[model samples]
Target: MMTIMRNTKLSTRTAAKEASHERIVCVAARAIRRSGYDGTGVADIMKEAGLTHGAFYAHFASREAMLAEAAGRACAEAAAAAADGVASVPPEQALTYMFHAYLSRENLEQVERGCPLAALASETARQTPEVRRVSTRYIKEMVDLVARQSPDWGQPGSHERALVSVATMVGTLLLARIADEPALSDSLRAAALQHLPVA
Candidate 1:
């Protein structure tokens, strides 16, 4: 009989390294959302992650590489957040929950914790090829996530509807964030929510 053996030392080291790497990525995720891709600095991300600047080399190749990974990570998190309360429900119900949640005042106020797509899409066109590629992949993934929540998913126009829906949601939130007056922000978000298919 063969028994599985645990390499405790190797496991411990691997776990620690992965924890540090994830800490860096999490910090980068929030930073990119709050500061835009161009505005975020590798040194600052490292500092915010509670590590020295020199320690970055162990986890990533370069700043662009880190940004690419961070963009992907941030987008993934935003998608998960958007899907949070609606995940196990029927498509119609999920769409209703998502439509309002994505356009909520709370989501608008929470920049660091909000959707990276809303925060970063405008700036993605100016990012490096690697970063653009990362953003593109996640954009498609997010669209797909929303598409799956539509009752017409797998139908011909489902993708287009999802794309439009996501565009409206992101655009509404973007305008809401930059609008100087609270009423304008509320109007933007409320209008978008009103136009939702379930609305």
Candidate 2:
């Protein structure tokens, strides 16, 4: 009975630790997107998560580790959200939905729930190799997911088109976010929406 109780205690401890880790990641993910990876700090994440600063090291190896995991989590969440938007529409219209959904004013304004690709992409090259690796992995996943929705999917050039579309979309979002004037931002989004190969 003592051994069984000890085992149960161990399981409970493990589960609690995992939950804490997940909470940290969830908080950090929003922090990273709202403020660039470099702008997000451990204290901010811990505080946002309602966790004490000292408890952070117990959950993650370091700030970079948290950022890497958070970036992966953020990217995966964004992609899944986009994929769901695509799935609701017909295949031929999937890319159109993706384009508008991604370029939507709501998406652009919702920094807390926006795309990690658009937020951290330019900064990835300067980040730790691990962070860059995680970003690359998710970007590839997004491109593949987008490719699947393209009208020419399975054709020789479909992937290339998807790559261009993803690149254009990210660039557009970046420019829109950086623009000082709302009109310029709207123009940037509108131009990309009209010119990009969404169909």
Candidate 3:
């Protein structure tokens, strides 16, 4: 009976630790996106997660390890969200919907909660290989998602087209966000939307 009791206590402690770990990762994911990887700090993430600073090491081996996991989480969430949006519309309208939604002003202003690709693009090249690996994996998934949305998905040039589309969308969002003038931002988005292939 004593052994069983100890086992139960162990399980309970493990579960609680897992929950705290999840909370920290969740907070870190959003923080990395809202603030660049360099801008995000370990103490800030722990504080925001409502956990003590000292407890962070109990969950992750190092800051880069945590950042890698956070980057993966952020990418997965963004891909899932984009896939959900695509699934909600008719087959013929999926690409159009994606283009407009991605380039929308709301997405532009919501940098903290927006696409991590655009949010972190300026700093990604300098990130650790682990973080870059996570980013690269999701980038391919995103390109595939966009390509699959194309009517000529399996046909020649489809992948290329999707590549261009994703690149344009990301670039447009970056430029729009960089522009201080509201009119310039609006025009940049409008121009990108006009060029995007509409179904």
Q: Model 1, which residues run further than 4 Å from truth?
A: 1-11, 88-90
Residue-level lDDT tens digits of model 1 in 1-199: 1232356666888898899999999999899999998889988999999998998999998998899888888877877776676776665688888887878778888998888878886898988998888777777877887888877889998899889888898888898998999999999888888886652
TM-score order of candidates, top first:
3, 2, 1
lDDT of 2: 0.89
Instruction: Evaluate residue 135 in candidate 1 and report its C-alpha lDDT on the 0 to 100 scale.
Output: 76
* Per-model TM-score on C-alpha atoms: 0.88, 0.95, 0.97
TM-score of 2: 0.95
Query: Candidate 3 lDDT (Cα, whole model)?
Result: 0.93
Candidates arranged by lDDT, highest first:
3, 2, 1
Candidate with better TM-score, 1 vs 3: 3
Per residue, candidate 3 scores C-alpha lDDT tens digits across 1-199 of 9999999999999999999999999998999989899998999999999999999999999999999999998998889989999999999999999999999989998887778999999899999999999999988998999999999999999999999999999999999989999999999999999999764
Q: Pick the candidate with the highest lDDT.
A: 3
Candidate achieving the largest TM-score:
3
TM-score of candidate 3 against the unseen true structure? 0.97
